[model samples]
Target: MLTLPGYLVHIRKRGGYRKRFGTRFGRGMDIPVKRAGARRIWIQAVSLGEMLAIEPLLKALASDERIEIYLTVTTSTGYALALEKYSELAVGISYFPIDFYPFSSRVWDRIEPDIAICAETELWPEHTHQAVKRGIPFLLVNGRLSDRSFKRAMKLRGFFRTVLLNTAQVYACSELDRDRYVALGAPSERVVTTGNIKVDVAIEPVLDPVTCSSMRAEMGISDGFLLLGSSTWPGEEEMLIDAFRAVREHDDRARLMIVPRHAERRHEIEAMLRERASDLAFHFKSRGLPERELDILIADTHGELRALTQLADLAFIGKSLPPHTEGQTPVECGVLGKAMVFGSGMSNFRSIREGLLQYGAAREVSDEAEAIATILDLSQDPAKRGKMGEGGKAWHASCKGAVERTVKGVLSWLDR
Candidate 1:
């Protein structure tokens, strides 16, 4: 189906056809084949977030002299990140195949993995079936099943049950996730809750005072409250701008920085900002820090979200505000000890949201009105903000060691 003229034409128009088709068509052989008698393991992570979550595990595995690691990603962004961050550690990195019988079979024959591991929710039927037929152990690490995905999988229970039964093991993110997998027909004994590896994301060292001061000066801000709208989706940006406008009514020094989920959407967001709030001065991060103080900053660059999080006094996570959007992860902001607020649509990270709320680390707002009110309230109460920040840091610290546990689990399987 992917080779159909219509599909080929569509993909070509979208661009990056070479990177997307290189693996499936057997075009890119940048990484040489493994040597004979080498112990090889193939690990697949679907995108940037999954790749990040598996970083520590990859590092741990890199120390073993006997094992050769091959990494694959489904998206161009993931493939780039895997290479950029893990090229030295990985023996081979490439785009995962399209999961068609021929494509998967060809890719598998080349990798010839002793064991195959799928990160997160990547359950490719053809790929898993081929591995099972070859007597290879197929495992799912950091497994999760959201309510929306559970309903969809239930519709194909018979098909998924057969696939799940053939799998060797599933290390889920939470007990709830494990239960959902069992309900969907995975053998209960094969699934275990191993907690979230995101909790173990490496924290960069604190920026020196000189660097922080220079960054602030470059941004044209001396003393101001920075509100960051991190990884926002469509519709949520407008709501954040509206809330920021309301926030400025009380304190003109309040500035808003927005980082859209997709950097390519900056033009659309810029147009909206112009049409809706032309009065506010806004600049893009790609353009060196504003010469003068600005009301809004658009972070259109990649790989700076973590660094930017350090500049924010308070953060509002995106995707949650729009009723239809399920929301992005706030774990990064939470780990930095930033006081955060999100909307009602957080089913994708329900466990994380609940944990933050339970620890007084974050707040949930229902709409623009509540979002505005909460941002204003948090801005006014320095003590409250401080408490929230400390609470978040404590919570983040408590969730550590999942990476170690997950690595140990994977090693045990290899030994068996």
Candidate 2:
């Protein structure tokens, strides 16, 4: 089969092959010794987004004296973030074992968690089988089946149903997600809509006016409206650059900021920016604050999206443009109360997208031209942008409490 080649491609794409090779293949893991009388929990978050989503849940679980947590992440970036954010909270943090025979089994034997939680769609067969054989309650938290994934699951309905059968509960993010999980053979009685926990995670503290002004000054902006490209993917940087060019033609006060999804793509983005907008002065955040006034700021860094979003006047959700299908999370923009836009490729967050649209919190553009025009219009009308921002903030508030409900469900299962 293509498993080895697929894993090789996966490992190579993220770089750091040698360091990740042993642990990923189930050779060595730093699982901590279990504390006497303490129930150990193993939580797997696939990447940065999933790791961020589980922050509130981790805090809630940590508050209980009887429980200990071991967290695992797949990507190098996620592992780094785990170390940075959860070093004190979690007992151990390591790379997730590759899902196969001895690999998944070895890690499972080491952790021997009383309970296991998998975020989003990480339903690894070998991993699930290990927990099932051990009689551990396997839970699917903040679960969703995106449009693309739903289609694929439908094609492999039988196999997927087998996996679903192994899960003790499916804590779905929306009624639609609950229905989708049931349709895919998750027992209807075991699946429940628990709202979106991303809404429950803490938002960045609001900056004071003086601090905001100083940060703006540091970025070389003196009264310009910022157009932000949040978590952009391939082909999106070029589209945003072209759109920024168009916006600058109408309003010279308009500036641009791009925080690409993968910081490793910095050189590619830098080359595109230089070629497309030679007249514009841009600075990379990795190089520290700009020494002079600049027209653009390229944020090629990690774990700073919410902080950067606080400075934007308008935001465009990335990976929604042409040649790309799934869209990035708009939760940060919604929570930060920023006026935003996205294309038609948001099937991944279909439930959240619909909620944002219904609340008048966002704009859906058909193409780059529409996105440019909308940005210009919103930039010119501060009152309209303000209303959309307030609407987004309110919508985010309405979706809170998922983390509380999830904690209750998880702990109840652990007790039983």
* Each model's lDDT: 0.83, 0.88
Error (Å) of candidate 2 at residue 276 is: 1.0
* Sequence-dependent TM-score of model 2: 0.96
Candidate 2: worst-modelled 10 consecutive residues by lDDT = 200-209
What are the per-residue Cα lDDT tens digits for candidate 2 across 18-46? 76568887677788889999999999999
Residue pairs in steric clash, candidate 1? none
Q: How many clashing residue pairs appear in each of the predictions shown?
A: 0, 0
On residues 355-383, what C-alpha lDDT tens digit does candidate 1 reach at each position?
88888999999987898889889987778
Candidate 1 residues lying further than 4 Å off, grouped into runs, are: 2-15, 35-37, 220-222, 287-291
lDDT for predicted candidate 1 compared with the true structure: 0.83
TM-score of each: 0.94, 0.96
- lDDT, model 2: 0.88
